[model samples]
Target: MSLETVLILISIGIAAGILSGLFGVGGGIIIVPSLLGVYAFTHFNSPYIVHIAIATSLFTIIFTSLSSAHKHFGHGNVEWKAALYIGLSSAVTVFLFSKIAILLPGEILKQTFSVVLIIVALKMLFDKKGKHEDPAEKKPEVFKPWLCLVIGALSGAIAAFSGLGGGVFVIPLMHYLMKVPFKKAVGTSSAAILITAAAGVISYFINSPAGANSIPYSFGMVDTLSAVPIIAASIPFARVGVYINRKTHHYLLTKLFAVFIIIVSLKLIFF
Candidate 1:
């Protein structure tokens, strides 16, 4: 890789790690686009560049989510039972759909990813239930196993298709449908992502296209060497993000991020 590309990946990692910790995502939101950007500038010629980007993002998420989840667990933010239920259920779909993802055209995949991001961004922007409410005033909702399973299944499909770690959907589902607190939802999503992304990366690794081994510093479709720098930077910063998540109200940050997602979606669609 060029020095310029390495520097950009490091920058992407820092941003991704913080966002993962703050929002319980797997950092794929930043990683995917940034990887695409890097490939564009570096003239990395390959028909499977999109697949490589997605696979690499999933691979990196394993560590990012691990770091973020550990910190959230330390803060008593994780709902372990819910996370396990959702994650285990999601793993099935993640594996199945990821295999399917490799068969689809790259343009189709990009379009699907963009649409999902727009929908998720809109939902985040308009949801006002927790904006001003005191956490102490709310009663925790009962955990429903069936609902979690459904949510997990849906999230896993999204993760496989978009490489977004399923957290974009998982967080909203748990928080809105299950009435989980925002912080707990984020924590739970991070834990769930660990499972979902693991399933995804495995599928991508084993299902890589023909001649994929010729790609430098890659294992199957995943660019492990590219992922190394991102993972290394993301781990420590994920803790920093978790600390920020705990220390302040995130209402404004959430709105800003929602806008950011919309912008990213548009870029994917038109660029």
Candidate 2:
């Protein structure tokens, strides 16, 4: 890869890591689109470019999520039981959906990703600010197993298809449906992303098409060469994002990000 490409990958990684930590997402929102842009800029055309980008994003998310989750756990934000239940359930669907994902055409995959981005952006744009509740007044976390299973299944499908690591859905579902606090939801979602992304990466690796090895710097569907620098940069920045998440409110920033996502989605859909 050229130095320019490597620099772009690093920058994408930094942004993705911070977003992953801040929002409990797997960072695919940034990673996948940015990778597609990188490929386009370099005139690297491939029928599996979308798959490569998604798979690589998932691979990087494994490390990013781990870093973010560990920090959140230290901050007492992670709900381990909830994360376990959701993550384990999601893994099943993630594996199953990945098998299907690999069969789809690159254009279809890109379009699907665009639609998912719009949905996530809308969720972010309309989401109400979470209020701080008194300890005594806060409801105990009481997520039902069945509901968690349902949420996990849905999230996993989204993760596998969109390479989002499921946190976009997981965070909102846990916060609204299970009544989890926003911070706790974000932390738990990060933990769950670790499982979902791992499942996705495994499936993408095993199910990769013939000649996948011919792709430069790739292992199966994953672009390992790209993933390495991204993961390395993301790990430390994930901790930085965690710190920011804890120290400040960013309602305006979230809204702006949502707008950015919408614009990106529009470009993907129309341009």
Provide the overall lDDT of each model, using Cα atoms, as 2-decimal numbers. 0.83, 0.82
Give candidate 1's error at residue 88 in angstroms.
1.6
Report clashes for each candidate as comma-separated counts: 0, 0
* Per-residue accuracy of model 2 over 1-271 as CA lDDT, tens digit each: 8899999999998998998888888898789889999989988888888888988999999999999999999999898888988998899998998888878643565468678768978987887653344221267776799988887887788778778887766875776578787678889999999999998999898899897656676888998888888998999999998998887654554565567667656765664
Tens digits of per-residue lDDT, candidate 1, 1-271, equal 8787788888888998998998888988789888888888987768878888988999999999999999999998899999998998889988888888888854676678679879888987986755776342287766999999988897788778778888777876776678787788889999999999998989888888797555687888898778988998999999998998887675665676578678767765776
Candidate number achieving the greatest lDDT relative to the actual structure: 1
Instruction: In angstroms, give how far residue 19 of model 1 lies from its true place.
Output: 0.7
